[model samples]
Target chain A: MTAAATAEPTRRDFLYIATAAVGSVGAAAALSPLVSQMNPDASTIAAGAPVDVDLGSIQPGQIIQVFWRSKPIFIFNRTPKDIKLAQDADWQSLRDPQPDSARVKQGHEQWLVVIGICTHLGCIPLPHQGGFDGWFCPCHGSQYDSSGRIRQGPAPLNLQLPPYEFLSASRIRIGENSQA
Target chain B: MSGYSTYKPQSPFMQWLERRLPIASLIHSSFIAYPTPRNLNYWWTFGGILTFMLGVQIVTGVVLAMHYTPQVDFAFDSVESIMRDVNYGWLLRYIHANGASFFFLAVYIHIARGMYYGSYKEPREVLWILGVILYLLMVVTGFMGYVLPWGQMSFWAATVITNLFSALPGIGDPIVTWLWGGYAVGNPTLNRFYSLHYLLPFIIAGVVVLHIWALHVVGQNNPTGVEPKTEKDTVAFTPYATVKDAFFIGLFCILFAYFIFYIPNYLQHSDNYIPANPGQTPTHIVPEWYYLPFYAILRAIPNKLAGVIALGLAIISLAFLPWLDTSRVRSANYRPAYRVFLLVFFAAVIGLGYLGSQEPTGGYVIAARILTLYYFGFLYVILPLLGLFETTKPLPNSISESVLREGSPAGASAPASGA
Candidate 1:
């Protein structure tokens, strides 16, 4: 073979490189819609609009569930004893650590709102059950404290906190972090 | 193409077609005159039975899909309509539902037969992997199909299973959302699952073609674990193996028919009859019976991620069994120690299955953990060690010898009237 034949990149090499690069880009571009289509659509996203909940009738130590974007939101009217119990628990040694103060709205500690779904496998936790004065997930035995902190079982995290803020002393808007 | 036969088409048209497409000759060679071990037992019949079950599932599934609505609102009512309104829809629905259970039953037995005979050894590694792939596909298809009715069990099962992905540290939540096609398992999830459920069976059928092709290439492993040596050691596939396969298939059909007619809902959980309620999860959520053992395995671990990883490895490990088992002898009959361990392994599996059905608490959790240890140990430890330490019995010289030997299993051997 001639030295020039092996020394330099041939025209065919340029063609091959260009073809492969273009082919890969085309394939990825084509695949984008297939993957993108699986995401939450426009309607599902819009369905998550803020829901104003009436906490007026809710009794202390009582829990009521309401839906926002098809998810169960548990609103608890915390009694003094429940708040004390939640505050007294050691927050540092927990599986997922957060103080009772952090979980509830500041100055509105009497009202506790959390997404009722278990962090382990999305099963709804039964209210007012388990050793903790909060909720117990029956599906995999995950127990949460009155503050909805993970206390026991296989759940990796505490009950998820939804985006919400108080509208008034007895009213709250869920699915919105602040006044709209 | 084991060189078992040379096809000579009798008719001119057949000869002409054979020359062009050669499908006629291929079928003749692969099925009609293919060589199979003469000493194959009743356990060997499950492969044919599984194939028939696959056909039954696809045909019934296709027909059922015609009337079944995929929307969340209509899905549950549509199924009810099928049961109450559509002509013979009840029969079709019952058969399709029960068919999945029966299909798993046959595949499990077929897999057990393979494991016992060391069919995954050496030349058949690819075949075994294909079988494992087929099994995985079947599992996904079955899980998706179960969700189609939009029952309470279906909804919760979908939720719990999809939540398994969230065990991943970083990208897990996103993947789970992508899988759901929304924030939760809703109409989009159901629609996609329906589409995939319809798409997967055809893919399984394609892989099955590869599986059988691989099987024909390397040939079958027999109960004796000895490769057939000559014409005396084997018989033609047609008439001999075909007849036996048909007989067992008929027996399997009888059991299937009984389920369809008498106790149709016996295999199905009653909770599924109730329409899906996302807000309220059932007190105790259990998966389908076929998945019980793995469910038990998953719950056996205390950590969420570990449990998910363990559940995944439990299935993926089956694909690597050919290498994991270091034994040269294929048949468990010769490996006495291996045989005992194998039976114990089966017991553990059955134990796990039972525990999977029960709540994962107290003694059941402890028992499931112990059995889970045995399940992994049998594959990773016992199988490798037994192959090295155990003194296996002397093997039969050939398939013919094993069958013809004195005190051999009666009726297992082909009749003296012979092929």
Candidate 2:
């Protein structure tokens, strides 16, 4: 066979291989996320274990940020008076009322548990206490009461309370509640 | 030296390749010699901008997928993890989230530019149709991406929108179930939506490539709508078109940066802050602003299936624009009545979008229906009839004539001997 004739198939073979390689890469890249979703990394779960929080260091009526599973969880100790104020009939008149029965672990009235996300837009609520004694979403003017319930805001629900359990009088572990 | 050289003879393999596969010729035709319209304006830069934005989204989205969780319980927390733990994760998340809004903004302008210049007319019909397809895919991609957060708004928005499929006749319920991967928007729904959301952008990238290929094939339509006939009437793509596109892209980038840095959450809904709660529903569920006009159309009709069909048709009508507009002249610049109609059409769309945001009440619903009717009427009735009856300005002999008439210094000193 002539040199030109012999070279032609090899070039075609190269092109075919290149095309297949690119096609496979694109397909693999596309499927990788879906496949990963089906099989989560074991280390991620281990890393996301319930975080141990030091509650004693947090003062009454003061909100403290604690990291749990890499997410910011706000831990505020509401004094009996602060709790009474939040439970006042005036506060109850607001859009979202604070739950009388605790949503978190029982007998932890002093410890207020809430995920830091603003009930309005997902921006982490900045702790502000000018007119309202609670979190404020800077994005659109959504306000929440001290109990993490929507007060005079666009947010339709209360801030989330991550599942948690008290390990001792001064320490709590968020993301693993014994009370189910 | 001869022994060291050890050169193989022009292998039968190499020579055969050169004879059978003309790769150089293919590259030249596809990339180098492809004739883009010489008179294309700065407006045409948006197509390139869109391609760039799509690339940005895909790159950021791929990185995000590496960290995102698809499960309902973990999805919201995973996003939080990405923000708090992943290095520069906050910036990546912000850019991708905000990049979506910017992409839509560019496309809206691109489509509007097409309308104003009648870029969708005649020979460019296939190009416009491809653009419509790309646009539809973009909306779907955006919708699916929104559901990935598993936030309250994300959950309810998915719930509300997927239920629209339920408005379809008898098969609607089943279709929705299949879409959700169950009876309601749950873990399976989030999983599949996340998968598809990540997948659709690449599909959009493919369609956008086709869109540009079609655009290159037809050559770009210009402001004057007059075709360039000769070398004197046209400019090369590199220095002329490239510079113009670069300038506009810089300006667009500034606008994009301003949004990303200053008012990042302006486009986002508030309720998405709370975790997804299927038991509780938000009082008001509004979609992203870009979808407002169609949402208004969806609410206008009393019948569910008919509303869905109308909403679909509102988008599909764009594909028929080339035939719908029977004007011999393409640009609105030369068409006086058409220019007026175009402005009215734009206002009607904005009005519909605004109405879509408000509660579907007594006056708003009526206004939405009226605007929606006008929106379709602008495309179907006014364009075709105007093309038939409206008197247009006298035609310029070439792009050079139009440019000179507009008093551009560049075209002032053209050869005096030219006809």
Candidate 3:
């Protein structure tokens, strides 16, 4: 074959090989972090591990702050009265009715969970149960209900909930939830 | 005899090439035939300067993007890798990062130049309006691009700005949801922002084309505000304007290079050095300096919706400038009153920027609100009313007269005779 005719096939082969290499590299690069995040190991977890928290100390109508993987997670134990107050109040008109869903383990009721970061400007939401009976982000006046739902103010969404799972009756692991 | 002697035989290829290319005609039209007003001063060169800066930004940005990671998990680490690992990545990263600030600097100067010379007047109104739109797009693109790094400031800035949409009426919740692409500002939001951030620069480039096209249609306004009368009153754009623009551009590049080399991180927020932690909020969440003035306006008003409206008006007000100034004279040179007002306007903007950088204290907030009110009043009230009442000094018939008057000693020489 002449150089031109032979060159065409060689060029096609080179392009095909180059594209496949790049495609594989891209896929690997993309999946690596996600896979690691998915299956966090003992060493990785130990360095900046999810802490198991005993919610027995958390009183009804009160929230407990727990550190997990260097992030603050809010674990609120709401009583039936607190739930009734949230549902009956006019402040329930706020957006984000149920933002703490991801933080709550399956079949767990009256146990609310959320990332302490404010839904507005990421200020840690201060826990209070006054007339409104919810959390308030003092930085921008973002109000949240007993269920960690945004009630009012500048926050666009309810507070985030990091993945977590229940280890026992009183214990909860606050990162890399196995169920998720 | 004439045909045989005068017409020499030529190759068909050469003839065909000459006809198709017409290099001489192309050069003639682009450089020589296309007229620019002779009186164009340093101010007129800013448009060209802005064009050059835009080109630099795109070039540097493309190179930096090659190494940048858009994922929240790796974005900060990737930026560090670029600085430490990649060859000359520090240079690329610094240039792209600081290039954003320099771009805004040049654009501000360009806009100010337009204002001073009344480049926004009459036939140039559409051009000016297009410039305003381009400016708005630049702001949005910058905001989105800043968030891709997923640093402290980037994360907080995204959170602060995204939350503003929640202040909207009934559909605010849906709007915010659509904006975030999820319940919270998380991985999905970051991914979409990365995609859009990569896309907006090209859109800015497209708008800039329209900007220049509109500019070329009206031709550039000169310092004297007097239109060119004849070929003598104008110079060819090639050696004259092109060389002058090149000189200024070189000087500007030197300053830019100085920043890239000497003080690369001077414009950057220090907190951005830290990786984003959603749980811990930075004590002070401030935007980039270019956005300070408008951010001040946003915080000035007590009401959320009103503050947003005022900030929007601050930009939209520029669009009405053509109609606002009713003065027959276009340039600020002849309008003493307007010059003072322009100075005041500049000072007010600086004041607002300063206030925006500080924590919104009671005193600062009150001052900002007052200044914000005055800022709008300057454009909406003073500009229009002054144009009606303020008497401007008589303008020279041509640019040459204006230049000669300023150059010579006061009342020292007679005016030049008509050519």
Q: Highest DockQ: give the candidate number.
A: 1
Model 2 spans with C-alpha error above 4 angstroms: A1-180, B1-35, B409-419
After superposing all C-alphas onto the true structure, candidate 1 shows an RMSD in angstroms of 2.7
Categorize the docking of model 3.
Answer: incorrect
Q: Itemize residue pairs with steric clashes in candidate 2.
A: A3-B12, A4-B15, A4-B16, A7-B13, A7-B17, A8-B16, A8-B17, A120-B270, A121-B270
For model 3, what is the error of residue A37's alpha carbon versus the real structure, in angstroms, after optimal superposition?
25
| DockQ rank order | 1, 3, 2
Query: Which ranges in model 3 have alpha carbons more than 4 Å from their true place?
Result: A1-54, A57-180, B1-28, B31-33, B408-419
Sorted on TM-score, highest at the top, how do the candidates line up?
1, 3, 2
The DockQ assigned to candidate 2 is: 0.03
Query: Each model's TM-score?
Result: 0.96, 0.66, 0.73
Which number leads on lDDT? Answer: 1
| Chain A TM-scores in order | 0.93, 0.71, 0.65
Q: Residues B351-376, candidate 2: write the lDDT tens digits.
A: 99998888766788789889988988
lDDT of 2 by residue, A1-180 (tens): 253477456766778789999999999999877655443345545766777877877887788886664446888887787677566636456566556355445677777889876543344566754245777654334667667777654455678889888889888888887767
Q: Write the per-residue lDDT of candidate 3 for residues A1-180, one digit (tens) a residue.
A: 354466456766778789999999999999877544323345534656567789788887778887765457888887887666644655435564442433355567677777887655446777873235778765555677776777666566767877777888778887767866
Please list all clashing residue pairs in model 3, or write none if there are none: none
Candidate 3 lDDT over B159-178, as tens digits, reads 77887776778986677666
Better of 2 and 3 by TM-score: 3
